[model samples]
Target chain A: MKKILILVVVALLSATGYGYYLFQKPSKDIATTKPYLSTIAPQLIAKFGSGQTSSSSELLSKVIQVSGKVTDIEKGKESIIIVLNEGIKCEIILDKNPPFVKGDYLTVKGIFSGFDDMFNEISLTKCYIVL
Target chain B: MKNKLLIMLITITVFGAFAQNKKVTRTGSVQFLSKTPIENIAAQNNQVASILLVNEKQIAFNVLMKSFKFEKALMEEHFNEKYVHSNKFPAAKFKGSIPPSVALDKAHNYEGVEINGQMLFHGVKKPLIIIANIEVKEDLSISFSSSFNLKLEDYDIKVPSLVKDKISEQIKISVATNYK
Candidate 1:
């Protein structure tokens, strides 16, 4: 009976450890994420033109892949911003610079946050350069 | 009628040339920090859009709430879902004019000014007065920096009793931008 009780306790401890591991798992990589920029940009522009603020509900908070020419690069104190196609912008929250430079075609995967009403721009966050 | 058309053309061309003096940047940055006894929380947003109307001494900035990135994923989620409710209030904006006391000519190069503006954030509009440094580069680029502090409660951000110690009552916000 004592041996059986010890085995049960060990099993319960392992189960809890596994649960914690799953709970603290990092987010999935952007390469595995879906929905490319070609589809998202037009939708965002359409919504902006129509004066609709709540149109892209399906894309919000979801990791998406976006590709475009780097029109401008903005260096921040802590991060970098890559503006694409004039209106679509991604915020890369990292100390290091991305591999590409301005005018280079690149693709990145990031979380689509929402639109900027004052600037009429689509905003994404926590971006990772995929290409 | 022909002379009137010619005069209108010249006027449009002159206005277009004058408007070219405006400097704009879509990738400005704004960072905020919250300090408390238990922890310090900081988030930075790089997708800040700023326009400097050099001719008018007016500046405007727009930043999306969802663009702010936090170090911890869980904390970021909590900020968007619980505190900011980013889906409801999408963006923050400021429209201000540089004080006339500061000069922006080539002779001055740099000036310190108090920008009096209206800030719109979290579905509320408040009057904001921020002191900032502006440098006009030889290349015609403008560099700006400002820091200000504000209470979270002023924007209707509520802190739960469970993690009250982890969050600060007043947060420090900094804005830095380079426009061309």
Candidate 2:
């Protein structure tokens, strides 16, 4: 009876360990290499907004480069907005202020993340000031 | 000279009459929801694009999709990337007519009328019917409120199985606008 109880306890512990492993595992498949420049475009990035907001996790931390003509400039309390065509805009929040104006052609590289409801904004890890 | 003067007067009167009755401003709001019952979503491009009102028989509303906003950073990210996919399609529009029995007066509150129309979201067009309480208050403000369902699958949105129970099949939407 003692040996049987010990075996049962061990089996229960192993089952609990396996359950925790599945729960804690990361769902995302992170890419070691940086995303190709050609793959990043205003049109391509805009396609990400077509589905449910919860799916953004799949694209988080992925490097992306987007190019578009600046339409408007919004200076906010914590960030700046660079608007592209067709009401598509990107908000860049900085540790320090970055100088930019509306209508300046821009190419930004950052990690794609979601922001204020229904917004797919990029957290700019690095911004390339391309005229 | 007299005939020319008469024609010019007629033209001016006609233009003025049309302008007085024209429905100029159109605006709306789309609320975002999660399973947690949080009601804090907004849009940046919150301008009403176009409107048409003819004898209370026809009405239309158009909204730019880029305007929705949220409070939390993570929620907002999921909204655009996972839910709205605003990058591919940029606009949500409603075109419909009001019930004939409802009268729109420049003064006095109008009864809440049922608006039947087609709602275009994520490039897919679907039939949408909403009840809106619209009033042309003091010849200035146009107040409206109508909540409707937004189906995810209608626009090809695939909700992951893990969180499927958290989201509703039809999202409730409310809209309000004031003329410029």
Candidate 3:
């Protein structure tokens, strides 16, 4: 009876530990830098969808840094768009500063927040030019 | 005098034809880097071949990132979530030009030319130069291929150390586009 009870307790502890591991957030070390020239020269980067889906909210509030050439920089009434590569473009809704120019080589560091699906944009809490 | 006028008109038409030939389609591709190769990366705006367009000296291309596809659901998720973050950054574009000496009529041979343009990714823009091979076919289709190295961190693409080598620092891009 004692052996069976100990086995049960061990199993409970292991399951709890595994559950915590699954729910843990991703490490920051995973973020890496890619050169702007390398991004466009041989590869094509573009947006994924129409942004109509209400997903990606769970990843909001996470800090990120991306480097690339500014293709189209639009300073809207309340937001900004800094396109990365032909395949990947990020819409940063600025709470502080204005948008970048079309030719500016910029490095943006900010949190990934929610965006409008139709327009394809995200609300940026903090953004600073790196390059 | 009438013959001279006709000759002058023919000369003008010939010159115009040469100028028209100078302007043609530029083609290329976008490669996604992961330990495993992902297939079927699609762009919604297929009507426009490349990311941007270039005429004489001006350039512009439009690409819908949301349309790009990957075979694996997890990789696609990581691409939009971890690498590209498609929700925040919706599209990628380029506005630049190729060298003047490169002829668009060249057939079946790799014409190495310098491509200079602005590459926008993950909400950042930077000037870029790439070596590309331009191939002109009998059908008047233009195809291009080039390869370059990229670091994920420059654009804030986070990949955990555990799977670091699984992804390559430099991604190779192969592209082919036909005029519509």
> Fraction of true inter-chain Cα contacts (below 8 Å) kept per model?
0.41, 0.00, 0.00
- lDDT digits (tens) for residues B53-171 of candidate 2: 54555666655444454444455456666876765554577788877766555554665577888988888898888887777678644556566667788877777887777666666
Stretches of candidate 1 exceeding 4 Å from the true structure: A1-40, A47-52, A67-82, A92-106, A129-131, B1-16, B107-112
**TM-score result, candidate 3:** 0.46
Window of ten residues with lowest summed lDDT in model 3 chain B: B43-52
Q: Candidate 3 lDDT, tens digit per residue, B79-157?
A: 6677777767866665668677665555565556677878777888888776767666786445555555455666666
The candidate with the higher DockQ, 2 or 3, is: 2
Identify the CAPRI category of the predicted complex in candidate 2: incorrect
Q: Is candidate 2 or candidate 3 better by TM-score?
A: 2
**Winner by TM-score between candidate 3 and candidate 1:** 1
User: Residue by residue across B33-150, what tens digits does model 1's lDDT show?
Assistant: 9998778899888778888887688999988887787766677778888998877787889999897765554535554578999988788889999988888777666789999987
Model 3, stretches more than 4 Å misplaced?
A1-131, B1-29, B35-61, B105-108
Q: Each predicted complex: what DockQ?
A: 0.41, 0.05, 0.03
lDDT of 1 by residue, A65-124 (tens): 767778777776667888777677787767777777888887778888777656566777
Question: Model 2 chain A — which ten-residue stretch has the worst lDDT?
Answer: A117-126
For every model in order, the TM-score on chain A comes to 0.67, 0.49, 0.42
Identify the candidate with maximal TM-score.
Answer: 1
Taken over the whole model, the C-alpha lDDT of each candidate is 0.77, 0.56, 0.50
In angstroms, the error of model 1 at B178 is: 0.7
